[model samples]
Target: MNNFKFSENIESYLVSAKDIFISKIASGIKTRDELFTSLYNTLLLPGYFGFNWDALFDCLRDFHWIDEYLVIIVHEDLPTLSEEELRIYLHLLADACLDWKIDEEHKLEIVFPESVRCKVEHLLSAD
Candidate 1:
């Protein structure tokens, strides 16, 4: 589908959120550290960012400071993370999004290239 992909939770988020901010990362990003750095800078995260998945979840948990109801993170490259790492990353992001949607009425979305899209969808479907 040319339209944005939505699993059950994401669809709910879009239905309720008002404002949206789309953050895009062009190609060539590789490595977990680079992925974190790119996302941190793009999102204008708090200065306390710890550059780990836990820190990422923490930062995303309270992103109202960015002043938007929804955040869509779009990436054009695959990180150097292993398959397991990538799966965990996607789960963490999805969990954070769902948590925010339930508690703060905020939403988060992560979009990658179609190649990664299939992997992401598969990962999410597993849960």
Candidate 2:
């Protein structure tokens, strides 16, 4: 949902990650594994935000598809959410991702609002 107007190249880059994600799911991969694998792989890569956000924006941005992964990170980083809340957040994120839509009604749950939600939701649902 980043309103910052990322370049089309950025969107295309994100789409690449999204393609991998869909393939993973279609192949019966676990959600956590898919997300973390993508994020961790991207984070370990070279550039800003630990790696260029545009180049891996699907896994990095504030979309429903990635909130569970961020929620897991939040437990490690925020030190506030209880084990149950973290679990709940993960479920919420999963539900949101499964039913994503570009319309105004689908408000993505942002545990931490670093980027836009709706725009990312749009990209996620576009597939």
TM-score of each: 0.74, 0.22
lDDT of 2 by residue, 24-105 (tens): 1112223444444444543342333333223333433343333222222111111133444434434444454444455532
For candidate 2, the per-residue lDDT at 78 reads: 18
lDDT of 1: 0.69
Strongest candidate by TM-score: 1
lDDT of candidates 1 onward, in order: 0.69, 0.34
Q: How close is candidate 2 to the true structure, as a TM-score?
A: 0.22
Local distance difference test, candidate 2: 0.34
For residue 14, model 2's alpha carbon misses the true position, in angstroms, by 20
- The 10-residue segment of model 1 with minimum total lDDT is 1-10
- Estimate the TM-score for candidate 1: 0.74
Error of 2 at 26 (Å): 35
